[model samples]
Target chain A: MLIGACLFAAGLYMVLTKSNAIQVLIGIEFIINAGVINLVAFGKYDRYHNSGQIFALFAIVLAAAATAVALAIILNVYRRFKTIDPGKIDELKD
Target chain B: MEQGIFIFLGLTTVASAWFVAASQNLVRSVFMFFVTLFAVAGLYVFALADFVAVTQIVIYVGGVLVLMLFTFMLSSKETLEKLEESRHPVFTLKQFPALLVAAAFLIVLVNAIFKLKPDQLGWILQATNNTFRPQDNTVTNIGTNLMTTFLLPFEAISILLMMALIGAAHLARKERSFD
Candidate 1:
């Protein structure tokens, strides 16, 4: 759990500070991994149901799927804006 | 011996994760994140989640990392160079707030975890009384549970995966003009 907390913090820092969208995605992956660790750790006690393991499996799959979609969106954004910096892409706000 | 291995893996994971957070080069950071993932998988083994550990390797290291690398390669090299040049330093006025937030979150989570007591949990006591026999392998158990108790979720996940893949393919395809 301490490990997960540290990972989560690192990831949160990454997400908040990184300007590049892909790096932000990396941060998001870090956060998901932290959650998975906590889930698996707690699930160790549930010998009969194994609910934690099941939930972790689903979380991993969802993370992958979300990453794929996010990458695709980032790719399109790059094509249109010619830059991947989240701060630079402010046409939507303007 | 087991405790030593756990400590070793935990150190590896945390160290690499910090490296990932601090590395200047995007490619190097990606590689470091790879190390972090592998170490976490080892930690999962210590937690008796063997199946999840293997799945973490296959999905994260094999699938996700490979996809990230592929995307990096596909992007224009000049843009990547610009991104590297414009990268933020580890400690900066702009990043100070983010650092504070992350540190605060970590402290809170660690304090909560430290306060938690597994021995006081009723479910854990019941499980112990029921004689929780640790399985040598959990693959069979997971498979049975997926088929029986988790059938709906299992099926839903398959569909979700399929739809996500199709959507990704569609989204990534080259744009066409229709006049």
Candidate 2:
């Protein structure tokens, strides 16, 4: 659990600090991976119910689908702006 | 033996995670991300969640990471070079505060987990009324549950996937001039 928490925190820090859009995506993956670790850790002890495992499965699917959509959006952003820098693409700033 | 395996998985996960963060090359980072995912999937298997472990590998490493790589290839010819340039402004700012906050959070979380009683942890494994019967096969059980109990959500997800496919195609299509 300590390891899980540490991994989650480190991932979150990278997500928050990274300037590259791809790095940000990696950070998101790390965070999700941390959550999966926690789910599996908890599931280890549960004898009768595999709810944690089921939840983890759903999470994995959701993460995959979400990443697919997100990558599409990132591609779109690159097409319009000619660059993938999140900071420079400030066309929608209020 | 189990502890040794756990340590190996843990080291692999942490090292790959660090590589994912530190690598300036986008493609390399993505590859390292794949490594991290694979390691975590190994951990899931060690935890006795065979179904989840398999799903993690299939969905994340096979499906999602490949999609990411495709996007990287399609979106930019400079994907390799751009990573060398620190154009993203987020990293330019001093990150000490962020590091401090993360460290603080880690300390608290570690303390809390250590304080938890062994019995409390054991309770997580206890069978409940809603537990799936051992007689049923896992894949079949999951399939039945999705079709019967979670039918609506499953249908909704299909609709969502369809919409996503349409949206992606629409977005990616080159604009045509009517003139």
Itemize residue pairs with steric clashes in candidate 2: A45-B125, A46-B125, A47-B125
Tens digits of per-residue lDDT, candidate 1, A1-94, equal 8899999999999999887888899999999999999899888887767788888999999999998888888887787788888998988622
B-chain TM-score for every candidate: 0.91, 0.74
Label model 2 with its docking quality class: medium
Share of native interface contacts recovered by each model: 0.60, 0.50
Q: For candidate 1, give the lDDT of residue A13.
A: 91
- The Cα local distance difference test for each model comes to 0.86, 0.71
Model 2 / residue A78 / CA error / Å? 0.7
Candidate 1 DockQ score? 0.65
Candidate 1 chain B least-lDDT 10 residues? B128-137
Best-fitting candidate, measured by DockQ? 1
